[model samples]
Target chain A: MFGLIGRMRASPGKRDELVALLLDGTEAMPGCLSYVVARDPVDADTIWITEVWTDEQSHKASLDLPRVQATIAKARPIIAGFDSQTRTEPVGGVGL
Target chain B: MFGLIGRMRASPGKRDELVALLLDGTEAMPGCLSYVVARDPVDADTIWITEVWTDEQSHKASLDLPRVQATIAKARPIIAGFDSQTRTEPVGGVGL
Candidate 1:
């Protein structure tokens, strides 16, 4: 499995809105096993997104998807910057 | 629940060793729901550690555990530096 751990920083007061935007329409994507958008307890302006996909290609393909493209466009405005992003290979877990 | 997404970079050519160190003796931790250790596909020397604990306190308490502390000590040497660290509140998920 492929895993992505990314931290997105929002405009000073736009964290909640960004989280909601990220959550909307994330489901039903092909090969997506888990998609989680969570509130960062330490950083008020940050959101931690953890995703598990069947493979790296599936995740790459999803970006070209229209729904995702639109969501990304909507989120772009509120996003302040990306704090960090990392890619990983998920070996196994309870959720997998 | 509490979520932690941390990226640990290993010294040059030591990624695999670091991953093994992090994984050893991780199980049996109290209140730990899911713990995933993954290799960063994009970065050769980075490891992404994703964790879900019952609560913030449980996660904090785990650090003081003898086993965990020992693991930390073992891992400390090969560790390069933290790329990113973020704390999150997991709303709900298939795993939890």
Candidate 2:
């Protein structure tokens, strides 16, 4: 399975808004197995997104979905910058 | 929910061993919702562990489990070092 783990920093005071937009955008992806949005416990403006997909191609294709594109456009303003990003190969786990 | 996201580096040529040990140790976790082990695509010796639990106490308590303790002891020798660790509050997601 393909996985992506990343840390994103929201614009000051907009973390919750950013998370809402992210969760709202997750409704209809075809190959997504798990998509989790979490808030940094200490850093209020930081968020972490963990995603598991059936394959790399599925994850890439999701970006072209109209809903995803719209969500990106809507969230762009509130997103400050991404801190770290890692692509992974999931072998086995509870969620998989 | 409580969440933990971290990156761990295994001893040279021991990444798969570490992954196997971790997966083996996952059974019987009481409040764990998800525990995913993924390998870094770019770095052969690195791993990312993403976990979601019902609460912080459940996570803390898990360390005392005999199986978990054994896994930790077994894995300690092959674990090179931990790179990053983050505590998170998981609000909503596909798995949880």
Candidate 3:
């Protein structure tokens, strides 16, 4: 499976709004096995997204998905910067 | 829910071994909603563990579990160092 783990810094005081945008419309993602949005405990403005996809192609394809594109556009303003991004290969584990 | 995302660096050539140790016996962990072990695509010796638990107490209690403790003991030598560890509050997602 393919995985993408990323940390994003939201504009100050906009973390919750950013998170809401992320969680919205995720139910329709085709290749998504798991898509979790989490808040950084220490840094209130930081958010972490953990995604598991069936394959890399599916992940790449999702970017062109209208809902995803729209969400990205909506979130662009509140997104201060990406702190880290890691692509991963998930071998085996629960929830996969 | 409580979440913990961590990056661990394994001793050279021991990434697979460390990953096996982490995946072992996770089925029995109570209150664990999701537990995924992934390998960093760029770094052969780096692994990321993404976990979601029912609560912080459940996560803390899991450390003392016999299977978990044994795995920790076995993994200690091969685990070079932790690159990052972040505690999180998981609001909503597919896996959970």
For model 2, the superposed segments whose C-alpha errors exceed 4 Å read: none
| Least well predicted 10-residue stretch by lDDT in candidate 1 chain A | A87-96
TM-score to true structure, per model:
0.72, 0.94, 0.92
Candidate 3, residues A1-96, lDDT tens digits: the string is 999889899999999999999999576778888899999988989999999999999889989999989999999999999999888888777777
**DockQ list for all candidates:** 0.40, 0.79, 0.78
Model 2 lDDT tens row, A1-96: 999988899999999999999999987798998899999989989999999999999999999999999999999999999998889898878766
Lowest-sum lDDT 10-residue window in model 3 chain B = B25-34
Question: Which candidate do you rate higher for TM-score, 1 or 2?
Answer: 2
Best by lDDT: 2
Can you rank all candidates by DockQ, best first?
Answer: 2, 3, 1
Candidate 1 lDDT over B1-96, as tens digits, reads 888888789999999888887777476788987787888887889888888888989889888999889989998898999988767897654344
- lDDT per residue as tens, model 3, B1-96: 999888899999999999999999576888888899999999999998999999999889999999999999999999999998888899887767
Score residue A44 of candidate 2 by CA lDDT: 88
What is the lDDT for B44 in model 2? 91
Stronger candidate by DockQ (1 vs 2): 2
- Identify the leading candidate in terms of DockQ: 2
Candidate 2, B1-96: lDDT as tens digits: 999988999999999999999999987798998899999989999999999999999999999999999999999999999998889899877766
Question: Local error of candidate 2 at A72, Å?
Answer: 1.2
Worst 10 residues of 2 chain B by lDDT: B87-96
Measured on C-alpha atoms, candidate 3 has an lDDT of: 0.90
